[model samples]
Target: MAVLVPYAAARPKTRLSDFLDSPERVSFSRAMLADVVDAVVDSGGNPTVLATEPVELDADATVEVDDRPLSTAVNDRLAAAADDGDDSTAVVMSDLALATPRVLSRFFDADGDLVVAPGRGGGTNALVVRHPEFRVDYHGTSYLDHLRVARDIGASVREFDSMRLSTDIDEPEDLVEVLLHTDGRARDWLLDAGFTVDVRKGRVGVRRER
Candidate 1:
């Protein structure tokens, strides 16, 4: 099966800027992408990065550039793959730092024409499209939109739910999730950068020891 990883090479992961500097955000984004690619490779899928610009990744992946909006680029690629008679295509987000080969294998092995793994706040973290007629929308509340679209197109749909697949590192709050859930490079980078979870006022949040 073909796995496509869409990455924003330019100005990536802006939400975490409050905690991470620009350079650190870039480095952390790349580290998360590497972890996702590693899971894809370990799952025995043909992994390719659909990058917005030319950026290097250390993991085993081939880079393809499409500077268009994410939904457009991914939809166009899926359509072309269907035209090429490919059976299915998987689009795995680049920021799933806690993702593992087991989670990815379960995602790819889901029994349906359209399988979706929803992110924490109404985003699509991963998807597998087995039907040529199915497409995607990555806008706000996209997980619900995808479910509606799948049903409208008469395609069988399944939803996969797991912390490993659902947890994408986007916000500052997500740093704690990574520290608690993953031992990957993203977590290591956070620790090396002096980030740790601290409890204050009956709530837990990430903090930097400086």
Candidate 2:
């Protein structure tokens, strides 16, 4: 099976703009992608980065540049691969900093026509497509759309759940999870940049200590 890591190179992590400037967002997003790529490589899968533009990644992976929205790019690639007789392809998110090789292995070893790792707030974080009829939709509540599509097409579906795959760092609340559970490059970057978890007024959150 081939692993494809899709990334938005031009403008990544826009939701974190309030916390990180444009350059900082790009740097942090790249760091997270590196961690994900390392985990995919460790899991014994060949990884190809699918990017919106030509962006250099410091990892042992190939790049496929496509100047299209994530959903369109990924769908086109998957369809083309299926046409080329590639039986299985896994589309993994680039922000899974806490992902481990074991978790990824489990995902690839799952027994089904389709394996899905659903993210918080109705997102599909990672997906393994073994059936030719299964395509991807990444719009709002995409997990539900994928499930229905798989069932409609008579594909056996399996949902794989792990903290590593599910914890995609998209929002500020996500930072708390990374700081508490992960020690990857993203976590190290946050720490080096003076970010800390703060507990006050019966609430838990992140704060810049510096």
Candidate 3:
């Protein structure tokens, strides 16, 4: 199975803009992408980066630039894999900063026509499609939307649950997860930028050290 990682090279992760400036966000996004690619490779899978634009990154993967909407670009690859008589294709989000080889191994080893690892806030973080007719819709509660799509297409769906896969670094608060849990490039980048996890009033948040 080939893994496709969708990366938004141009102005990625706008939700973190309040915490990270434009250039910082870009650099952080690349770091997260590298972590994700490394995890895939370590899990014995080849990853292809479906980037929106040309991106310079130090990772062992093939880069394919497709500026189309996320859903369209991903579905095209799914369709192509189906046409090529491939048994399955996997899609992993680029912002899975905490994902490791062990987490992805379980997701990849799961048996189903449509295996999904849902992200926080009703988004899909990763998925493997064995059924050729299955396509993805990324807009509006895509986790539920994917389940519905699988049901409608008579595809067997299995949900793989893991904290690492569920966490995709997008919002400011998400940085805390990387600080607390990740031991990869993403965490190193945040620490280098003076970002650290702060605990206050029994709540965990991220704060930058001046």
Candidate 4:
């Protein structure tokens, strides 16, 4: 299947957005997208990046980057992928803390015209569409609200586990939960990137100033 990673917002999009509120979170978002790509490539899958930026720095031959807004550009990129006519398509978000190949494999294994996992925070975290000429009406919560649209278009539908397709990284509280699931590799990454993690040795919060 052709995997789609949509990076719609830039590093700092607007004040109303969460990731833009702090510079640290902006860097975190960028790394999160990169990690999503790493997970896909490690799974020996074809990956594409639908970026809102003009140019992509890490796009390889196996990956093609498209610059477009999430509402319009994402579908445009997927349409281009479908043009090749060689693969089914799965459109996924980039800010998942626990995105593993096994989790994604579940979606690939399902039998449906569209396999969707509802997002924890409304909308959908992942979408798998088997039909060409697939049009998107990606407005507020429409990713989940558009099941009728899929039915209207004569497409079959199925749902997957939410934990496998979560995009829960818009708040610091979410970050705290993500760190709970970070394995050795991801933990080492956090350390290497200057984010410290220390478990409480006693009934006290772990703290080390500087």
Candidate 5:
């Protein structure tokens, strides 16, 4: 499945998104996007090179999906990715702190025409469509609501336990969440970058202790 992460100067932010000011946090977010991609690539049991790209890189694998607004740009890219409909595709958001290798494995196991990993707030963190045009009518929570759309299109639909998918880092609470679930590179970076990693309140912030 293919993953989609749309970013910009003031990227794809939802009202309840977890965000931070430190560049380290931002950079970690970028790295997290790649780590998640690696996990997805490894999930392929066969010879799939795994279409790879960064949220900030330039390439045909990516389209300017952030320019057209939230879901529109995403759906537009999905529409574009549809050019090659033979591959099972999964579009993942870039903000999920809990996104990990195990989560992706579960997602691959529950593959269907459409599979959505819902975020804490409205909208979704990851969207998986087995093929382009898998669903003709996509609007509203079609990302999360694809279950019904898949049925309408006679396509299979399912939602599995995922490592809470991250979309855009908007709200401060998410920063806290990121620290709790994120580890290794992101965690070390946050500590070194002077961003206090607090999860007691279930949020991440930039107030470093001492």
Candidate 6:
């Protein structure tokens, strides 16, 4: 299967700006992207990085720079894949720090013309598009919009439910999940940066050592 990993290199993980500085945010974002790409490769899928700007990464994938909005860039790839008669193409978010090969394999093997893995806060974390008419819209509540788009095109839809696949690291709170559940580069980067899980009032959060 062909996998498209969308990445914003210029200004990534803006929600974590309060916790991480500009350079650190870019580094952390690239770490998560590497982890996601590794998972996709291990799961037997070919990945292409659709980046906003040129980026240097230690991943075995092709880099394609498309400065267009997320939806437009992804749809263009989807259309091109359809024209090429590809069996199925997947759009995996670059920030899925917790994604593993097992989770991605299950998602790729799911039986559906359109398989969606919804992220926290109604975002579409990952999706496999087999229907030729299916396109993506990355606006607000994009998960719901994807489902509606699938239904309107008469494509069979399946929602793949997996905690690892659902978690995309964008906010400072999300860093906790990577530290707790992941053993990849993202987790290592956070740990090396002195981020540790802190429980306050029975709620889990991250604390960076000074």
TM-score of each prediction: 0.97, 0.96, 0.98, 0.77, 0.66, 0.98
For model 3, how does the per-residue alpha-carbon lDDT over 43-161 read when each residue is reduced to its tens digit? Answer: 98889999999988799999999999999999999999999999999999999998999889889999999999999999999999999999999967999999999999999999988
Taken over the whole model, the C-alpha lDDT of each candidate is 0.91, 0.89, 0.94, 0.62, 0.54, 0.94
**174, model 4: CA deviation in Å?**
1.1
Query: What does the lDDT come to for candidate 5?
Result: 0.54
Residue-level lDDT tens digits of model 2 in 1-210 = 699999999899999988888998999899899888988999998899999888888887899999888788898988998899998999999988788888999999998899999998899999999999888889799999999999999999999977778888999878888788777788888998789998874668798777
TM for candidate 2 is: 0.96
Better of 1 and 4 by lDDT: 1
In model 1, the runs with Cα more than 4 Å from the true position are none
lDDT score at residue 84, model 3, on the 0-100 scale: 95
- 10 residues in a row with least lDDT, candidate 5: 45-54
lDDT of 5 by residue, 1-210 (tens): 455654433433343333344454446655555555455555552211122232452222333333455556555656766785546656665555456667666775675777777655555666667756664333355455666566666877676544455433446555555566667455565577566755466433455663
lDDT of 1: 0.91
RMSD of each: 1.1, 1.2, 0.8, 4.2, 5.3, 0.8
RMSD from true fold, candidate 6:
0.8
> For model 5, how many clashes?
9
The CA lDDT at 64 in model 2 is: 94
Candidate 1 vs candidate 6: the TM-score winner is 6
**lDDT (10s digit) by residue, model 4, range 28-114:** 566666667776766655677776664343534144455555658767765776788745788777776577777777776788878
Better of 2 and 3 by TM-score: 3
Which regions in candidate 4 have their CA more than 4 angstroms from the true location?
12-22, 54-65, 184-210
Model 2, residue 167: what's the lDDT? 85
lDDT of 2 at 104: 96
